[model samples]
Target chain A: MELFFQFVSNTGFYLADYRNVIMIVVGSLFLYLGTAKHYEPLLLIPIGFGILVGNVPFFKGFGLGIYESNSVLHYLYFGVVTGLYPSIVFLGLGAMTDFSSLLARPVLMLLGAAAQMGIFFTLLGALALGFLPKEAGSIAIIGGADGPTSIFLTAKLAPHLIGPIAIAAYSYMALIPVIQPPIMRLLTTRKERLIRMPELREVSKKERVIFPAVGVLLCCFLAPASIPLLGMFFFGNFLKECGAADRLAQTARTAIIDTATILLGLTVGASTQGDVFLTGKSVCIFLLGAVAFSIATASGVIFAKIMNLVLKEKINPLLGAAGVSAVPGSAREVHLVGQSEDPENYLLMHAMACNSSGVIGSAICAGILWSFMVGL
Target chain B: MYGLQAITAHNGWAMAFAGALIVFSGLVVLSFIISQLHKVLLLFEKKPVDFQNDLERPDIEPPEDKLGLSLPKQFPADIREIARLYKPLVEALGETFCLSELYEILRKNDFPHPHITLTALRESEILIPDGDGVFTWNPPTENDDNEKVEG
Candidate 1:
C-alpha cells in the first residue's frame, strides 16, 4: 500500500495544477478547431498535441520539460532555438511558390508594403504598453502573419516569448478566414469588392528564371540581416525557376518543408508549459497580436482604396487584405469575399501576386526589426 | 515605464517610424526594380540596339515584342482529345476559375503536360481568356459533339 501511494504521488494527477488544466483545455480547443473546423490542420494538430504533451505535469529537475536542457524535446527544439526550422520552411515555401503572378503585376507589391505597416504600428503599441524593446519587436512580428518569420524573429529577439508569439502568429493565421471577412466588409463597399482586376500578362520563361536571382540581390543588399531567411528562400526559388534542378526543388517543397513544419509546430507547442505561458505578458502578447493582424488587413485594403483615387484602372480593395503573409489563406478569403460581391470577379491570381509580395514584405520587416533591435 | 514617455525613453518612436520607413522603402525599391526588370529583359532581348545601325536605318521597326502575346504560335492538333479530357474537370470548377486554378487541378490530377495543354487551349481558343486571369471554356464545337455522339 505504501509503495502504491508513493507511485500515485509521482503521477501527473497528483502534481497537476489549474494552469496545466487551462493550457490543456486551450490545446484541446486548438485540436478541435483544426480537425473539426479544418483550420490549418497540418499545423494546429501537431501544436495541439504538443500542448497536451507539454502540460501533462511532471516534477521539476527530472529533465522532463521542453525547457530542460537534457530532455529529448529540448534537443528537438534546438532547430527552433537556433532559427534553423523556419529558414528551412522558407526554403520549401520558395520551391512551391510561383512568382509569375507578382512579376506580371509589380505595383500590387505596394499593397504588401502597406500591409507591413501593422508590424511597426504594433511595435509602437507594445512599447507604450511597457514591453521591453526586444519583447516588443518579437510581439510585433505576430502582425506580419507569417508564422515562420514570427518564430525566426522571436527566437532571435526574445527567445523567452517564443511560445506565446508563435502560438499567436499561427492562431491568427488559422483564424484568418474568421477574422478578416468582417474587417474587409467594414472597410470596403460592394462596388470595391466587385471591382475586377486586369489580367496578369504572361511572364516569359527568362523573366521567370531571373526573378529569384534579382530578389536575393535587391532584398539582401538593402537589409543584410534578412540574408539568412531570404537567402534560403531565394535559393529554393532559384532551384525551381532555374530549370536545371527540378528534382532538388521537388524534394525541397515536399520532404524538407514537411519535416521542418512538423518539428516546428510540435516544439513550439511543447515549449508552452503552464507556468511559463500563463503569464500576464502572454495575454498582452495575444491582444497585441490580434490588433497587429487586424491593422495589417485594414492597411492593405485602405491603401488599395487610396490608390484607386490616383489610378484610372482600379484594383479590388479586397486584394489588400491578402497583403499579410498568411499566403493562400488570406488570399483565398479575399477571393471568396470578392466572389460573393460579384461572381465574375476572379481575384485569385491578383491576390496571389499581393500575397507573395507579403511574404517578401514581412521578411523585410522582420529583418528591419531585428537589425533595429540589435543596433538600439 | 508605460505610455508616450516609455516610447520616447526607449527611442521607440524613432525606431518604429524608421523601421516602417525602411520596410516601405525596401519593398518600393524592389517593386520598382521588378517593374522595370521585364522591360530591361525586353531591351536585352532586342537585336543589340545596334546604335550606329539604328542611326543609319531609322525607319526599321523594332520587334513586335510585348507582354501578353507570349502564347506559342503552334497549336497542338489533338484538341478534341485534350478537350474531352479537361472539359469535365473545368466544369468541376464551375463558371469562373482563373487559369492558375485549372493548372493546379490538372497538376493535382497527374494529367500529362499541364503547361503545354493550357497554352494550347489558349492558342486554339478552347479556353477563352477574359483579358484578366479569368477564363471560360467554350461550349463543345459541333465537330466535338458529333465525334462524341459517334463514339
Candidate 2:
C-alpha cells in the first residue's frame, strides 16, 4: 500500500501545479497555431511539442529535465548553448538568399540599418525597467526580429533568459502580419504607399561573386565579434555565387539548415520551463519585445520618408516596413499592404531588398551588443 | 531602476548612440560598395587586346569571369556566362525562340552540349517561357555585356 502511494506521488499528476498547467496550455496553443493557422509552422510545431515535453512534471536529479546535466535533451541543447545551431541556420539562410534584389537597389539597404534602432532603444528601455545590462541586452535584441540572432545573443549574454527572449522574438516574428500593417498604415500616407519603385537592374555574375568577399571583410572589420554569425552567412553566399561549389551550396541551404532549425526550435522551446519562465521579468520582456518591433517598424518607415526628401526616385515608404530581420514575413507584409492600397503595385522584390539588409543589420547589432557586454 | 538615471548610470545612452551610428555607417558604406559592384566589373570586362595580336585567331578561349582562368576544379560553365554568351544569338533569332532554333545555332557555333546548356539556361530562369513552345530572353542591361568584348 505504501509502495503504491509512493508511486502515485512520483507521477506527474501529484507533482503538477498551476504554473505547469499554464505552460502546457500555452504549448498546446502553439501547436494549434502551427497546425491550423500556419504561423511559422516549421518553427512553431517543434517548439510547441518541446514546450509540452519540458512542462511535464518530474522529480529533479533523475537526468530527465533539459536542465539536468546528464540528460539527452541537455546534450541536444548543447548546440543551442554553444551557439552552433543558429550559426548553421545563418549559413543556410545566406545560401538560400538571392542578394540580386538588394544589389539592384542598394539605397534600400539603409532602411534595414534604420530599423536596427529598435534594438538600441529597447536596450535603454530594458535597463530603465530594472533588468541588468546583460539581461537588458538580450531583451533588446528581440527588436532585431531575428530568431537565430536573438537565441545566439541571449545564449552569450544571459543564458538564463534564452527562453523568454527567444519566445518573445519568434512570437513577434510570427505576428508580423498582425503587428506591422496598422503601424505601416499609420506611418505612411496613401500616396506614399501607392508609389511604385523603379525596376531593378540586372546584377552581373562578377558583382554577385565579389559581394560576399567584400561584405564579410567590411562587416567583420567593424564588428569583429560578429565573425561567427556573419562569417558563416558570407561563406554560404560565396559558395552559391562562385559557380564552382553548387553541391556544397545545396547541402548548406537544405540539409544542414533544416537540421539546425529543428534542433534550435525544439531546444529553445524546451528551455522555457514554467517555474523559470513564469516571472515578472518574462512579462517585461514580452512587453519590451512588442515595443521593440513597433519602434523598428516606425523607424524604417520614417527613414524612407526622410530619404524621399532628397532623392528624385521616391521609394515606396512601405518597403521600409520590411527592414526588420523577419525575412519573408516582414517583406510579405509590406507587399500585402502595398497591394491593398494600389492593386498594381508590386513591392515584394523591393521589400525583400530591405529584408535582406535587415538580416545583415540585425547581425551587426548583435555583434555590437556582445562587444559592449564583453568590454564591461 | 527607472528613467534617465538607470539608462545613464550603466552608460546605456552611450552604447545605444554608438551602436546605432556604427550599424547605420556600416550599411551606408556597404550600399555604396554594392552600387559600385557592377561598375567595377565593367573595368574587367574590357578586353585584353595587347596579347591577342593574331587577327585570324579563333578566339575559342572562354572569357575571363574576373576570377582568373585557373580554377581549383573544373566546374560546369556559369549560368550567367552561358546566358551572356548565347544572348546575342537568341536576340538575332528575333524576340521569341523555339528550343530547336537555339540548339541549331549553338550546334553551328560548335558549342559543346548545346542541349544540356539550354536546359541549364531554362532552369536558371535566364530563359523564360513565352507559351506556344517558345521562350523570351530576360531584359538586357548594361551588365549584359558580361562575356562580350571588342577586339
Best by lDDT: 1
Candidate 2 Cα errors over 4 Å, as ranges: B47-151
Clashing pairs in 2: none
Contacts from the true interface found in each model, as a fraction, amount to 0.85, 0.88
TM-score of 1: 0.83
The residue ranges of model 1 lying beyond 4 angstroms of the native Cα positions read B48-151
Give the per-residue Cα lDDT of candidate 2 at A146: 96
The DockQ-based CAPRI class assigned to model 1 is acceptable
lDDT of 2 by residue, A207-274 (tens): 88999999999999999888889999999999999989999999999999999989988888888889
Per-candidate TM equals 0.83, 0.83
The local lDDT score (0 to 100) that residue B116 gets in candidate 2 is: 55
Assign candidate 2 its CAPRI class: acceptable
Per-residue lDDT of candidate 1, residues A215-250 (tens digit):
899999888888878999999999999999999999
